[model samples]
Target: MEDKIMPTVEELKALAIEEIDKRKEEIIGHAKHILNNPEVGFTEFKTSKYVSEIFSKLGIEHDANLALTGLKGNIDCGGGEGPNVSVIGELDSLRIFEHPIHDLTTGAAHACGHHCQIGSMIGSIIGLIVPEVKNNLSGSIIPIAVPAEEFIDVEQRMLLREEGKIEFMGGKQEFIKLGVFDDVDMAMMCHTSATNTTFGVGGTSNAHIVKYVEFTGQAAHAGGSPHMGINALNAAMIALTGINANRETFLDTDTVRVHGILTRGGQAVSSIPSQVTLEWRVRSGSNEAVVANSKKVDRCFQAGAMAVGAKVSVTNIPGYMPRLDNPQLQELFLQNAGHLTTKDDIDIIDNSHNGGGSTDMGDLSQIMPTLHPYVGGGDGVGHSETYLIHDYEKAVIQPAKAMACVVIDLLSNNAAKAKEIKEKHNYNMTASQYLNFQRSVAEVIEYAPEG
Candidate 1:
């Protein structure tokens, strides 16, 4: 009689990588298609449909429209009895009108390299779903398409909130509120970066609060009888000046970032502006600093309204928490990434190294073991017009293979790696506590000085 031999974890990973490599063209093509047809957050109908069609073709069981434009698909491992691991992709684009490939009408652009995220995510799914790989793993894998990670479109998102479409502006935040991450035990995702370095891990991000500001005043003729009207645009300009004036107070160690844009300055040039709107963001390294800076920014808004006798409304929306990457999970990613590149190409920063940006993934990391690493394939500045993917293979295939192998490592051996991680992780907060804290951040303050 012939003896039966079980496949080793490395053999299973090799099988998955081979499968992913086989479909490289298709994966890269899909990413390019997404790059050409960009859509903004919460309005990714066509993009959602495209992702759903691909999921259907892959024969994966998926639920769509969880948070308006988000989608989740699941594949259970035959080995069974282990944690559920999630591979996530962002499905929205930034509004970069000046980008060369930006939509002519909508101005949506993939300047942040999110299109590659979907490609790498799908590529990882393709790799892990190979029958040979699935049969050997002991847990499930979830490939999810998430929405609105950029945190733009503040006015429109606030409208969505009023209509009860979502409780939070960020996709992951809303996903948490909707119980989308409830079943998932651990998560990992790779973001495309302009860095020529092959891979990066072990860094933190800023915590932040979102603000929607509106200044209202009386409208009158711009060229004629201008004295009869109050200028809301002037009030907004004063508010912005006040904000700038407080910049010196920000501590260098705190890494405070306060920025905003005037989304709507006026109705028409012929008329005095009656209302002006702004989308503001306040971010800092620590949560306490974020709270303090947010209060100072609010006072600046009030100062603007008081200076101009305009009624100002500031709506504070809860933003992301500082990112806390699981050390164990990051090591797994690093090990997998090492297979494709030399150690010199990878940069492993300190856990306290703040990237000076914010992400809702940070919010998820507060409650679960999550990994948000960076991979190279892109050049030019992120969120800028010049940003473009220069190497699809590095941006897509390598990360996909790495993520797949990481999953195999975690789920193999009856998911010993995942179990160890879960047992050792000391979560910062529970879902209920996170929700209460976010809700407490929500408030609408109206400041109208008495005459």
Candidate 2:
């Protein structure tokens, strides 16, 4: 009788690559479908459902929840292993993009290419489970569909938080509450961006940024009783000016940004507008600095509120998670990218110095060995109506393939690689530490708004 010998790692790797290549069209199609039906943030109903169908067809076990819109599957690369790795996909599409099919209801387009973000991750999962690849499995790869990376619509998110629907603002942050990463050793995510580089390696100094500041005072008749009512709108105006007053104090190294506008200054020209709302954002180069700067800005609001004797309540809507990454996983991505693209074409950015942008994945990075890399789609412009890719297939497909390769190589490969990544990152952050930090920032934070 012929022996049923297990497949070797080399054979499995080859098969995984082959499967990814062969199913390239299907994967891209899935991505484009998501692109065509762009959903914004947590409102990814169709996008999530469609991805769920795909997962169901694959016969993969999944968990659907209020937080995670798409599917999450567990693949035992190890018959029984050392560490489990998770490969995640962002399901919610950016609301703005340079597309013709615009949603009038939501006014959302897939501006940030999240449709493709989750799509590539999902496709890679399918490729990872090809018969040959599955046969050669050695570790675990958890495929997940995560929600609300964009963190837009602060008022709605605030409502969600208040209703106990979600404790944290970002999707990944909420997932962390459920101990999603308890068993996962490492994590990987790819961002579709505008740039032609080997590996877009940079971590965002993500901030626990604030969104809304409201000041309440008694409203008086416009022409009748201006002196009797405290002007809440005026307080917001003064707060705006106060922040701007200290703008010169902003250090060049810190990407300190403060911008705001008074939503409700007053009803009439003659009367005092008591209720005022200021929507603003403050950010810096890294997570810590952002929090520090926020406190300063929050104090400005407090001072202004006190100046007008208006009751003040500043609520921070859960904003994006700043990029906190594992350099180990990033190095692995860089190495695999070198193989995918020519060396001259790849530039491994030194983001150790950059912590300016914000992303929901930053929350995940704080958990496990996570790496979020950008891919060049066009010029430096993103989230703009004019933003576009020169070649949909070349720009997106190649990076999609690279992301898949990274997940497969690192997660489904030998136990040593995953172990090395997990140990190097030392994702020892406690749940309480993360939650404490979350509340600590938005409540007590003071700062100027970003322009």
lDDT of 1 by residue, 30-148 (tens): 89999999999999888889999999999999999989999999999999789999999999999999999999999999999899999999999999989988988888999999999
22-127 per-residue lDDT for model 2 (tens digits):
8778877888888777777667889888888888887877777647364567777644565776777888756553455457677677777776667678666776
The candidate that wins on TM-score is 1
In order, what is each prediction's RMSD in angstroms? 1.5, 3.9
- Compute the lDDT for candidate 1: 0.93
Query: Looking at candidate 2, what is the lDDT of residue 32?
Result: 80
Residue 97 in model 2: shift from native, Å? Answer: 8.9
TM-score to native of every candidate shown: 0.97, 0.89
Reference-based lDDT, residue 290, model 2: 71
After superposition, candidate 2 runs with Cα above 4 Å error: 1-11, 66-70, 97-99, 221-225, 260-272, 317-322, 378-380, 411-413, 442-451
Alpha-carbon shift of residue 96 in model 1 (angstroms): 1.5
The candidate maximizing lDDT is 1
Residue 403 alpha-carbon offset, candidate 2, angstroms: 2.9
